[model samples]
Target: MMSTLAERIQKQDQRALAKAITMVDNDHPDKLSLLSEISGQEKKAHFIGLTGSPGAGKSSLVDRLITHIRNMDKTVAVIAVDPTSPFSGGALLGDRFRMHKHFADPGVFIRSMATRGSLGGLSRSTKDAIRVCDAFGFDYILIETVGVGQSELDIMKVADTTALVLTPNSGDVLQIFKAGIMEIADVFVINKADLPGVQKLKTQLKEFLHIADPKSWQPPIVETISTEHKGIEAFFEACEAHKKFLNETDAGKQKRKEQLTYEVYELMREELWKDVERFIGDDPSKEIALQKENDPYQLAKEWLSEWREKGGGS
Candidate 1:
């Protein structure tokens, strides 16, 4: 049954892909076992992350990049993470609407995820969705996240390469530097290059790169008017160069290993929290402490004791 579902995924069946992703996202005990059985057998895919300030034309750039990847006869999967409404717990789903050109294409799979208050700016489901894409046999998987402060930095953990997008005249180039985005970016893109101050922004970025002297490989800056599909080839070339750099650097291998370790610990933490909640039932002692203005650390210790007593630690 798993093999059949996996085959359906490779055939680009949208329903199968969606279901498979949900299975992974749920992270149920049985599902985890199944995932382990099939994990190493899945084909590897190129993972790319795109992020920028809101209104930086990230969606448009992704649309154009998808076209470029398709032109290479490669299948693409896009996970576009949008902000959720705090009250409603729902996303606008606007990113999928922007990439309408690929709506009917089986070769392109696009999914919109709600950030769901994940601290690092990505949805908890984002990694699982990417795994589904990888298992589905996509040649390239692109992750697009809402560009808010330090949230965009989370993309570096998930993507093999990250592109920090900025508009030519948004004055965001300096913000990127201040936010420490410069350190995480494998490539920088000045999107909306047709706008005024394109040259100025490009010059500023070049100077910043020179000062940073980014170790062995310097991040390349590419200009793109994504709506017009201009300079996309150059952007792809930069992505390829970054990939080559990763292959040649020992740092890249260590980085990936650390990322995997983090993911494992993250998963374990979530599971342990769930176990605690389940042990305490609806009226958890931790929740009661929050109402009384009690010490959270003490309450946490109490909960942990209760949890272990209930065999949660087992």
Candidate 2:
């Protein structure tokens, strides 16, 4: 059954692709088997990440980019992450509404995922979802983050080219520097360029770039009016250039290797924490903070010691 699904995904069947992604998102019983079967089938789909502050017009830019990319005869997939609802633990999935024009195009596939309270603005399953899309043979896989703030820098983990969108006079230039966004961004897009302070924002970005003194890739700051369909081509050209730069310098290869390592450790940490949770559940008052609980540090130490002594999971 999993192989059947994998074959359907490889054939670029959108429905099958969506089903497989749902399996990954829900952590379905067969997810690991499905993923293992499809692991090496992901070709070379470019992974582009779009992130910035709320109201930065990231969805708008992405919508326009989809049109541009399709014009060039390429297929695309999007994963738009939205804030999780506290009450229901669900997402409004409003990004679908924003990019609904592409819905009728079979070559374009879009999925909205809830952040589920993830501080990094990406859900745990987002990377896996991208892999699923890649295996399905999309030419590009674009990820739109929840657009929170600095901590959203986790884009570095999954994207080959990350574009940070901002608006004129938004004070995002200063914010990006403070949040170390400058280090992760491959392209800086100043959206709503027709507004006031456009040039001023550009000037500030250039000054920061100079101070950063980048060696291999000096991130290009492009002004865009996404509403008017302006600068979309330029934004894509910059992205293409950056991709080429990464390939030529082999920096992209090294970065991807490092990110894969991070993903491994991240998964291990999650599994270990789940074990800890199970241990606490067996003795809530003593393991967790319930009046008789031990300090968190000591509790962690004891768990580690016991885990080692038991040779893990015994």
Best by TM-score: 2
lDDT of 2 by residue, 46-136 (tens): 9899988888899889999999999999999999887776677877765577677889999899998777757545667887898899898
Residue-level lDDT tens digits of model 1 in 93-203: 654776888988888999887777574377657777787788878888999888886558788888988998888777757777887877788899998888999888988
| Ten residues in sequence with the least summed lDDT for candidate 2 | 285-294
Q: List the residue pairs that clash in candidate 1.
A: none
lDDT of each: 0.80, 0.83
TM-score of each: 0.89, 0.92
Candidate 1 shows a clash count of 0
Candidate 1 to truth, TM? 0.89
